[model samples]
Target: MSTTTIDRYRFETGIYRPPSEGGSASLLLRYTRNCPWNHCTFCSMYKTEKFQLRPVADIKSDIDAMAAVVDDLKAISMDIGQNGTITRDAAVSLIGKVPALNYHEGFAMLFHWLLSGARNAFLQDANSLIMKTGDLVDALHYLRSTFPSINRVTTYARSRTLVQKSPEELTAIRKAGLDRLHLGLETGDNELLKKIKKGVTAKGHIKGGKKAMVAGFQVSEYWMPGLGGREMTGVHAAHTARVLNEINPDYIRSRPFRTIPGTPLHAQVNRGEVQMLRPHEQLLELKNMIGALDVTSRVCFDHAMNNWRHPRSGLLFTHDYEGYKFPEEKQKVLELIEAGLNAGNPVSGAG
Candidate 1:
């Protein structure tokens, strides 16, 4: 075991990733410090921090440190294979030498990443694509070069930011190794978008999403069912379906609205400015949106928040909440929603 002066990579606190990415073996890499537009009323993920992009040198150093750890683990594996077992002293000595790689959770995550074949990496701390195009492209290239085994690279992008990027810039980013872009289209109702301070209109969602798809990036658009609340439910469902129909993104992920304490939306609920839809009402809204969708993309309800259940059977329809392919499973999904509503579940009056 030998000590090295590699710069240690420490993840910033208050990080968030997509729920669907939970089982992914992707290495989490932070390119930016936080969300650039932290004004979304329903979100509090980046409220405590201001956004800043890490310098290319800083990011590359972190990547280098990660590579060094991977190499060391490979060497240890070889030694263990030949020697039958590694001694406690040998194990402690080997790990103690790398001062920069001393993060306990990081080492554990890396171990799982390696076991999962190290085939993917996810950029973190929200809106990695908002970095300067050239810097982001360079970072992507360097990351891929350092870890050739990574088959996919993904990041979250705001619709407002995506609309600002030129087609050429997005294509270059995709070519540089970013395989997918996840955009939160939350709702396509203009009034609701303003109410939530999402800072993007329905048209913006369609334009931004279509641009990414045209640039050859697999696009996943997230929609929230109860975002528009009780009065706006029908409008929310109809308009959101219209936007997704236009973009025809590779995936439409449903994230049913759940209020977080201290958020502006919660305050509105307290003041009676907005009425949050009940669980059953949210499912009915989902059914309306699904029936209205005309696209060929897969529709997913993969998040825990979306696991709507019937009170009697305590079962979630569509077989385990994995989601269903649109146009094909639309009828079956609608029937499931109808069954849940028919169960005579009470809609809670508390927002």
Candidate 2:
């Protein structure tokens, strides 16, 4: 039988690839069509598209489609192989065992296992926080009901949007099974925030971040080094570290700033209004920023976008011994890049 097929995954166009912090996987649902404040100079999430929200019904349909397939699996018992590794021939042979078999369910069961680690699910498409809290809660409830085995649920949120929401609203959201909130804090320097058109003041980030913490939600605040350029690197590092100290979120993530074509920051570069720091300079800035970190937040260098891709590459990541951690091992990465640049290699920043 020939059945129509629909692709289930979707995402925005950007130079970004998922960072490996803690090895968490990403899945895209695309609730927010584009960044609400799309003027971030160094960003390319929705550079060519107008910002908007995907309709709730459309989102519901996507979930329903997946659920429908899962429902089919509940109707019959497929054969179980050793360690649950059902080979294709075995799966087909098992499907033949059922009186009335479902191809959709068989395919979906394999996909479900692949997506959720056969354990938890990850939803994505930039900022799902743009969804109304009630709508999001309903969706979360639906997913939990459907999967029943999803251990943790998570999503991305903007500081400004989070700040605009009432604490009560956020608490209710927390109760709805949102285990983690990823906030792209880029840089907490007020000047850097303004320049990026982040639309949230440094204070706003702290306010919203604190609210999430108050609601018992784990918060990951992500930032980018090299965003301050040459002129304000010190101020940017110092201020960002200071802000993180105040927010003291569960995770402080670093994304090394890189140039992407068609972004506003690229234009700034052309006009000489922005300066992309050298690899060594960026490491110095990171060092300053890390040195200034008086707070006890766990620093993460997990993402592929980070200058330091190795989680335990050097002193920064292994500083639990002496109780001194800075850039955790980013200087080692910086030194490698600096050598490349000196040797006349293109030396683009790590992703």
Question: Which candidate comes out best when scored by TM-score?
Answer: 1
Candidate 2 on 1-351: residue-level lDDT in tens?
112322331122222323431232433344456566777777778667776776666666666655543443333324343334424444344345532335332343344353445454445556777678888777777667765766777777888878888888788877877778888898888988888888889999889889888988888888888887898888889989888988888777777787778888778887989877876577668778876776656676665444332322332232221222334544553454344334432333542
Once model 2 is optimally superposed onto the true structure by TM-score, how far is the C-alpha of residue 102 displaced, in angstroms? 17
Per-residue alpha-carbon lDDT of candidate 1 for residues 1-351, written as tens digits (9 for 90 to 100): 334443443433224778755453678888898889999999988788898989988888878877776666556656666342323433444566765445544655655676677888888878989899999999999999999989999889988888999999999999999998889999989998998999999999999999999999988899988888899999999999999999999888877788889999989888999888887788778889988999988888776665566666665554332467777888877887887777777342222
Question: What's every prediction's RMSD, in angstroms?
Answer: 3.3, 6.2
State model 1's lDDT. Answer: 0.79
Quote the positional error of residue 208 for candidate 2 in Å: 1.2
Checking candidate 1 for backbone clashes, the offending pairs are none
